[model samples]
Target: MASHRRIRSRSTKPSPAVGFTTAALAGVTLLSGQSASAAPGEPSPSIEEVQKKVDDLYRQAGSATQEYNKAKEAATEQRREVDTLLDQAATRADRLNESRRALGTFAAAQYRTGAVAPTAALMFAESPQAYFDQTRLMDRMTDQQQQAVADYEAQRAEAAEQRAEAGERLEELSASQEALRTSKQNVQAKLAEARSLLSRLTAEEKARLEAIEREKAEEARRKAEEKARAEAERAEAERQAAQKAEAACAPETARETAQPPAQDADPGSGTADGGHAAKADKVIDFARAQIGKPYVWGATGPSSYDCSGLTQAAWKAAGVDLPRTTWDQVEVGTRVATQDLLPGDLVFFYDDISHVGIYIGEGMMIHAPKPGANVREESVYSMPIHGSVRPA
Candidate 1:
């Protein structure tokens, strides 16, 4: 592993009697009185600092992954637009060719009739029509010939415009492709830095860090479950209250058997309308199959995925098109409150809205977490909730 020579505190307060080296490589965490080493001999930095640094790097990687996804989406759209323009340009070129052939026939008839002057020729003149009209040569041609010449000129102009538009689209596509490359590199660099930091830790320290993460994940899951239960209970109470009010006001014969309020429609339960249930199930099915696939920064495929890529593909499998980044995806569907998130709703996280996952009800979600991890289910509350959207 590549190591950066970096000086970090051994402790908040170190023994002043010990000698310490000041500098190391860019990412190496040097301890007081001990040079940072990847070998087991180097004294470990505080577990807390290592954990924080790793988490920060992973967050940065997630941000870069979203950037990559956005650029990729733009590039995909730009390429499509460019292709459409190219097709239009080709069609225009064909039209122009046909127009030129019709005009050529007219010039041929005028040539054989000796109506066209030797010096005032149609083929060599800058303004063919003006020259023919000025020399009275157009008088010898049929009305259709005159129209053909005009059509040829108009077709040429239109073709030129189409070609120009195609050129501009190609330029935009090129820029978006470059941006995609930069975003991919940024993600890789951040992940590499995180890996380097992890490599410096001792085996016991690594195990402890993993334990800390597991504990946090469990805690988050517990809290999300608790919140979901509370929302369900609250919704049930409201439904009963409304039913009682209806019973008090209506005649016994006029009253219909009070059915349980539709749980699917309860805003607090985050369930979808019954009509969307089948599609949402399909989305969840696709997402679940992707579990264990490695989380590559910009991938959106059968083998690997970035956060948004996974959700986008899952929904696409269910015949819904989602934008390629969390920021844009959130805007595509109806906004849903956190408590109302149903399966297949996209749950965005973090203040920047850089991360997202597919909510699978019960406060769980399937997501491509970050580089070095795999697609898996975790609590929606595992990270700070920015918002939610139901991309039905």
Candidate 2:
């Protein structure tokens, strides 16, 4: 696992920590503070206070949304498994019934012929093999009758096992369903609180909040450009150093180095990078098209999306299926440093990795920000960095 690295827009200035601890404290304050219904003499929470509280609520909601997505995905898989198990159990049960009918017919035929019933013979004998040996029953019975008895026993045992397995899957499905419900409730509650906080702000205060966001974005953009420049410079320096090393080598050694070594070529190697780049293009294009969509909690989008939902769908457009939720999404693809992020790379945020966005270069990303917000381009540095992944 990659460690979470903090990336600030302004390295010189002290930035407020947006870690979970601060968010949790802000949440408690929001719930306990007099901002909601301040008396005439009491003062209401300032715009910054409201902003912090609201941001925290949105972050919490995002976390819960990821949890909901995880549980939902699990439930879907569990339901499919349960369905298959039940179907197999039913099929086995049908076979068992057929075998029982065959056994019944054999018993009836034996009773009518005044021969020992198969059930009675087995009950009186110490064992089936002994009974067969003593009475020569194996020789007397038709091959079909012996096969029917074997099929009945095997089918009965198999049917019982299948039913038990199905029952266990059903229980797992129930647990997943319960988790889904709890996560859904948590997301709804957090979003509701965030809405309430925003609603308490005056029109002017809201405008100021938007302005603050814009300013933050601008700062992040500046920092991103600076970082990109530094990375480019470093790359150029490395290239120059390599060239200098080659130039300083002995003439014979340089000739040998210039001539590439012979090795077996991989047939598919040539297209690997191109294929990855093409897929990345598709992913970026898909994400760009959903820029204005609403951020619905669990939506995978034709119209709306959540953070991970949008990423998963975008990658799906490129023929790569990603796991639902930021937690799982972070685990896919090649892990890359924040400074090495490329367009279409999945950039994760926060220590818990509850949020993700598709990097579009120069530190900007297109993401579904939060509930009541539309998908839009934002600076990746707006939140603490939790590393990145290249899905392709």
Candidate 3:
């Protein structure tokens, strides 16, 4: 049985990454007209419809939050790259300046020494070899001055290239920052609309909506229990079948072999399954400790977290690093079926794969649900499941 935990009731809200569609606009229109009282002959929207619209808005907001996270992470990485390129450019510029100074010194020394011009030396020489031997101007210049000039040109070109790269990366960072802002705005707008829709409900309507939510949660929980039982039975059956096969082969192996079969391997030998289970325990422990923390969008911290942020932090505690967004986190680790979910496995939700939770057996998951919500344990089936993953 799942342990009882206090689930807080708060305003349900989310952010938006993509713009709302026509259906969303229609929902807004319907919600805008809702109130505690309606005129006779007017049709008020049903509590169920309002509930659904609110849920959809939250889903959209979750999607937008993930996008905001992605953009923010991208901007951080690009900024780092820009800094590295600028540093390289500065170093190259300094080298170029040194080369120029060296060439200037060579010119100053030649002028003070009353050195003859190459052309003058060449004209006065009796032979080509005599010209080269007498002045050694071309040879000496080739050895030092020519090489210094080459170094200066190379350094200048390299510095220009690095500066150009830094500029391009800076532009990319700006675009990412813009995307982050847009996603933030979209999320705020969606949440505002949802809050408005909920606030307009009468006392009776609010009670009805709460009842409907509870009913849905109960149904989801029932389904999850059924699936967990089924999966457990299947696993047991497979294990028994494997054992029987091994037993049947024992006599034949003894008759054919001169030596006895080796004993079973040690469980503590750091087997793959054992290692994964150990890490999973750590991940679950970390997630459990974070319950009741506030859900702050894009935050991955000891104090507060968003959905993906919580998952990333939890796995990081287990010595596994997850990406900053749900989109990327989903791509790592091996995909598993919902029924096969083990404790500490990551279960993603929604068609957009915007939300994620750490599976903690009996179909329950720990997650940072939304803006007004806190990190808490709930049924994985509470939301539509996109997929599950085993991150060892």
Candidate 4:
């Protein structure tokens, strides 16, 4: 589970590196009397449309929350059951301690050769009745110890299963919230865009229009809340899926038994003389040549470039077409551990996947950070490091 880790808001400020702007939305609006939303005497806030969207949001939200609660309850019950079982096991251990004391005393008495008043034979007995008593004691003690062991093992297994289930539920919660936020943003953006250029309509028409807007705003907010809940559920589902995928995406490793040890390997250090570093050096050099260029999200040219766009253009000069997104770019090659990072490696950031930069050796990297931001050489640590990725 994420615990108290606040969900990283994908939202950002306008200056670039990575951010969002609903400003684009204000420029878009279907305003007062500009167009008939429907037939004459028709109010666009029809019961049908509002009901449908509202119902969908409610249903999705309810289902997701319900599932989360169920999973949570199941996990709680499992935890309680495990604790109970462990307590019981501990009680049995106390019994085991008593048994050990009895056995220890019995052993010492039996082994002594002294003329003791109460000998092992006397205390434990030698007749058929006493012999039977000793045999039964051995059997009863062994059974009790075994039962405790079995109970503890079962409880441990149940506890582990419960934990996994809880984790899966939590992941669903995160994903659902993410989706909800996105959907709400979209709706809000669309609604805001509608406000501009609505002055063309008459007063009565405007009032009618305002009423519709109020109704829509309320409905949108409600749906957004619903979306939030749904997002929580979906997040968990996505996390479970990712976990499963990562598990299945195992890397191949050589297996050997009793093989001679190989020579010690060094901490890979920084850039090397040849191979990837050589090609990477050329790309870096070429990118540096374009240092005076402006940052453009999707632009790729002599004039401007977005972070990924710049990397793509540079790589193109070096004869490769790396995938565009930072997430995809990470898979371009084997991942370089943070400690072993080198020049030409690509470091990425999160939130809309808006920032990307190419490593320039040391702790330095080059990137066209964000729109209105100039292309420059910046430290990888200057911004948050989601992680560093290498091209394949």
TM-score of each: 0.73, 0.76, 0.79, 0.33
What tens digits encode model 1's per-residue C-alpha lDDT throughout 109-218? 76775665647576666796766674575575668797998899999999998888889999999999999999899987887776677656666776676667666666
Per-residue accuracy of model 4 over 1-392 as CA lDDT, tens digit each: 21211122332332222111122122223223243244588655533344344333322322232233334434455566556656665665665565556556555644552344435545656686876676577567667656656655656665566566655655655565555455445433433333322323334554554455445544533443444444455557767887887666654213323466666576564333245655776778889898868754345677987576688788777777886545456667766665555567777754434456887643456787543346776545544466776673
lDDT of each: 0.73, 0.76, 0.78, 0.53
Q: Which stretches of candidate 2 lie over 4 Å from their true place?
A: 1-36, 39-43, 115-138, 142-146, 231-275
How many clashing residue pairs appear in each of the predictions shown?
Answer: 8, 0, 5, 22
Candidate 3: worst-modelled 10 consecutive residues by lDDT: 14-23
Report the C-alpha lDDT of model 2 over 133-175, residue by residue, as the tens digit.
Answer: 8556544655678889999999998988888888898899999
lDDT of 1: 0.73
- Of candidate 2, the 10-residue stretch with the lowest lDDT total is 1-10
lDDT of 4 at 83: 64
Candidate 1, after superposition: displacement of residue 85 in Å? 2.5
Please say which candidate is ahead in lDDT: 2 or 4: 2
RMSD of each: 13.0, 8.7, 7.9, 22.1
> Which ten contiguous residues of candidate 1 have the minimum total lDDT?
15-24
By lDDT, the best candidate is: 3
TM-score head-to-head 3 vs 4, winner: 3
